[model samples]
Target chain A: MDLFEYQGKQYFARFGIPISKGGVADTVDQAVAQAEESGYPVVVKAQVKVGGRGKAGGVKLANDADEVRTHAGNILGLDIKGHVVKRLWVEHASDIEREYYASFTLDRSAKKHLGMLSAEGGVEIEEVAVTNPDAIALIHIDPVDGLSLDTARSWVDRAGLDEPARAQTAELLVKLYTCYTEGDCDLAEINPLILTPDGRVHALDAKVTLDDNAAYRHPEWDEFAGSDVEDERETRAKERGLNYIGLDGSVGIIANGAGLAMSTLDVVNQCGGSAANFLDIGGGANADVMAAALEVINSDPAVRSILVNIFGGITRVDEVANGVLEALERVHISSPIVLRLDGTNAIAGREILADHLSDRLVAEPTMLDAARRAVALAGGQS
Target chain B: MSIFVDENTKVVVQGISPTSQGLYHGLRNRAYGTHVVAGTNPKRGGEEIEGIPIFATVAEAVEATGANASFISVPPKFAADAIIEAAAAGVPFVVCITEGIPAQDEALAYNRLVREFAGTRLLGPNCPGIISPGRCNIGITSGDIALPGGPVGIVSRSGTLTYQALHELSQQGVGQTTCVGIGGDPVPGTSFIDCLGAFEADPDTRAIMMIGEIGGSAEEEAAEFIATSVAKPVVSYVAGVTAPPGRKMGHAGAIISGSKGTAQAKMDALAAAGVTVALNPTEAGEAMVDIVRKLG
Candidate 1:
């Protein structure tokens, strides 16, 4: 749920955090029009989720309409860390007298919301944290009490931010905290909380990661959902309510749990077969869910054989076996399926599956043996 | 004695509505010898569910039944509040079985549990819970797979993986003192280190088995703790070695961001810390059996 630069800025603005006026552009003409609206001397920034956009030449200063068109044209299709730029954020360039850093994220160890304010900014914060840890003022915010204005001011002062910029920076930090909490963001970071010569402070860049679990509370997130570049198989699986990740291999894997599903993939590789996808049916191995999972995996032409690995805990293996049998009757699966059933009622489940064994359908006792059988059936040496 | 819950532990079930899964599991746990004392539901206060009294709040339930531990099975939205209520009620331990709670809410609940209710130990908001074999089962893990008063101690981040490891160990005639599923959330209530420390202190536990996945530095941190603090034989298994980066495998916390929280990193750290890093669950079980037998 990483936000594009423009979207991040928009999210920041929702909390009344001051951000430079910006518009998203998909074309050179649109970039030029955005430059006209925001006035000249704009920054044509590539909108990608990856870092180091400036290092990859995806960001450039455009002093005029011609410069905006040239820079936007160059950045629109630019690739930064494997993310191809499809959108440009045209923003009015800021005059910075000083740069500072501010970010809010959860510190898992501390079990608190961590707020970091540093006098040094615009460069990699990790380097700053390593070289001069004292330069960064790290504050652990109580989620119940949150960040108080006085505490924020003290944090700004402790970070050694300029005296004139302290009040505004603290104010903005409070707003950013609000944006982080109320906005349901996992992370809210401003890489250069810049101070102008006129003593005005504003956020130069915004990097936000939204919480996917909080989507039910915010209906407006549908716009962000629409922008996701998902694989066709992944999209179809999502529609079917199956957790599936498409990979580049021949053996389609399905398991009961997340850890087991991943282990299934690793064991498939260990037994001389690469997994075509990672699919976790979760706790529900009922008929409807299994049929949907089979249809999604069956739709993948790269899959030569399917591996159904079920280690039922709360999920009964006998019920899962019946679901698989029922799904087999419903879905027209092209690939062979090697089933491994274990845990609660696994013996009963395997006995039921023994009657359905064929060239296209098989069953194994252990996960390792099942993986080997699946690899062999997929034409790999096991 | 077991780490968290044993035969003497009195339990209160929170969020026990008619259709609540916690109510169903609570009854099952009570049937299995866990002291199921009371239940809590704001609307159904003063009512009795299967002969267990229902109170308006955790505090009332605790006061009425003298329950020291809480089993929360509420929906995600009310989970954090339920934990808070349990903690405020002077419950020493809370096992939250609700999943899909917003990370922020969990963060707040965790902080409050630590800062305000310092004596309270929260097990999970997304976990399967803890079990002490024949003693008492506090959470959702199947009680049949475990054997009481065994020599081995188990801790894990994944629910089914923990169950699988326990099943494997049980099949090999290895029993456990206690098994704790700390849950696989970014901000868990109890940590690997917390459970490790408990297992280290418990005299009944001889060897320990840890199951970790690719996500967070909890496993790595636990390895660091085990290297210096823990004197017991430790066998470990890390899942998601073949998982691709940047995608959350299954658990909310099981994601590989950049080069950190990789399965290789966790395994290497544990191996360097003198832990027997097993390739799979069965291998881990075998390693545990070997350690326990050597100890004997």
Candidate 2:
């Protein structure tokens, strides 16, 4: 899960890493108050989980209270990459002598922790990788060996960091590694790890992505739960424990696995119709889960037809069919459902669905047929 | 001639009991003629689950049953330790069917297996495990859908999609050599490259059907491997063509981050490697059918 910049900074601070003093605010008055408390020349950054906030004019410098109010009012509702700013992070602006980048993520192929450091910063690392790949010093650290001070110092030297700030940068890199490994973070990025005119180095921007699977180990992450700026449908789906992504198309999709769910959406498009949403019921296709999924999709006015494709292995097709039937009784679905059941006990599952065929309920012989029927019912003629 | 398992491979169940999913799938595996000889449960060491002897440790189970492979079905929290225990017991092959294991734990387990237990092969901490049809059934995948024989080797990142591919192949009267789910986790114990390499080396497996979803560089790397090493006809299908970026599509690893790990990117890479890339799973089945028929 992506955290807001403020939350990322706070997470950084927890690892004893130095960040610019900052405060988060929810209102214009609170922004001004935070700015005043942090001293003048504060950077009012829009607290959003997305990138390109600066290009979108979501980050503004305010020297006084009036300017702080003006910028807060402007940025609070400013949309960056479809993310509307609801909160503001006002931090004391730093005096930068130079900018650099540092991040630690999993080297999935190598099965190691990958540390990327570059003297060139304040821009996308991908850009630096394209222009001058040598500018970025990449290091692979085994989770067993971990990141050491000597290793980090050598890395800092390789990245050609400012000699004066190399010690502090290396120290900060060690702390960041701790936060990345021990803090249950998928990614801990400090873009533009800034060097001050005085020889101090610290993180200027924090882009942290926490591992959702590690949530079981870290209970403190509950504080970051309410920080997400999600749409209504996404929030509802999260509440219902369904893996769903809302889209603008007409055919609502529900499938058993991630790959099949995505394939269901692709097949809907292949059948000349777009999908209203992407929902994966996972391994559980019980009555309650199916009803919850149907109810969530039914709430969307854009969904004209629903397609549920389950190729049962651990999940039996008979159970899925019974679940669908039982779900129909629990929820009054306005959109017609096209189910394509295959795999274990599918003959019995098809037999169960045979008695319930109608305009509202239909069964298809295959996933492609189901998509074709759902797309046509959704008014996407094919 | 199967890659991972066959009639001679003895299986030991870790965290197995009457109520555990290990025993559940273990029983089913045994019913399918798999040598599910022993189970490990510290509490039920002297007990038995449907005639399968229970042992206190994987070492005892391995010693008693001569099991060369271990099937892990422990919960997420204990999964990493269970893997270590199985590997410590000197099991040559360890397949972890438990899902939702923390990436850190998975990483540490992989590291230990690499550093300390170098001889042991680990498949997944989150996967459907493997099946050599009419021979050995390891994990949660239903054995009925699998056709027992040769000509096709299948590997997938998704369990249901693997079942779909198997169903599609069986429906067309094409038998498979072995099917492996490499798992969709960011740090899978085994990879597409590993399975692809095994499949390429197997004599009975004539053609390969690879089912990949948008996520890591594993599939792209496998494409490169296929281009350089694999000599068989390869048909590929990657899911999430219409999926939006940055959203987890059910599988923990099935997310498109930024412009990377997209279905289009993976498909393009595989296509550039001279592998047949299908638009969807059904079409992929057709491509594989045509390829196999040409081989005949």
Quantify all predictions' global Cα lDDT against the true fold. Answer: 0.90, 0.91
Best by DockQ: 2
Kindly list the per-residue Cα lDDT of model 1 for residues B14-102, writing each as its tens digit: 98977888789899899889999999999999999898899998888888789999999888888889999999999999999787888
Give the candidate number with the greatest lDDT.
2
Write one digit per residue (lDDT tens) for candidate 2, span A1-382. Answer: 8988899999999999999988999999999999988998999999888778999999999999999999999999888888889999999998899999999999888889999999999999999999999999999999999999999999999999989989999999999999999998889999989998887898999999999888988999999995683778878888999888899999998899877888999999998999999998988998999999999999999999999999998898999999999999989999999999998889998898899999899888899999999999999986
- Candidate 1, superposed: residue stretches over 4 Å from native: A77-82, A131-134
DockQ category of candidate 2: high
Native contacts present in each candidate (fraction)? 0.66, 0.84
Candidate 1 chain B: worst 10 consecutive residues by lDDT?
B140-149
Model 1 interface DockQ: 0.70
Per-model TM against the reference:
0.95, 0.98
Residues A243-298 of candidate 1 have per-residue lDDT tens digits of 88999989999998888898889888888899999999988999999999999999
lDDT of 2 by residue, B98-193 (tens): 888888888888999999999899998678999999999899889999999878999999888899899888889899999999888988888898
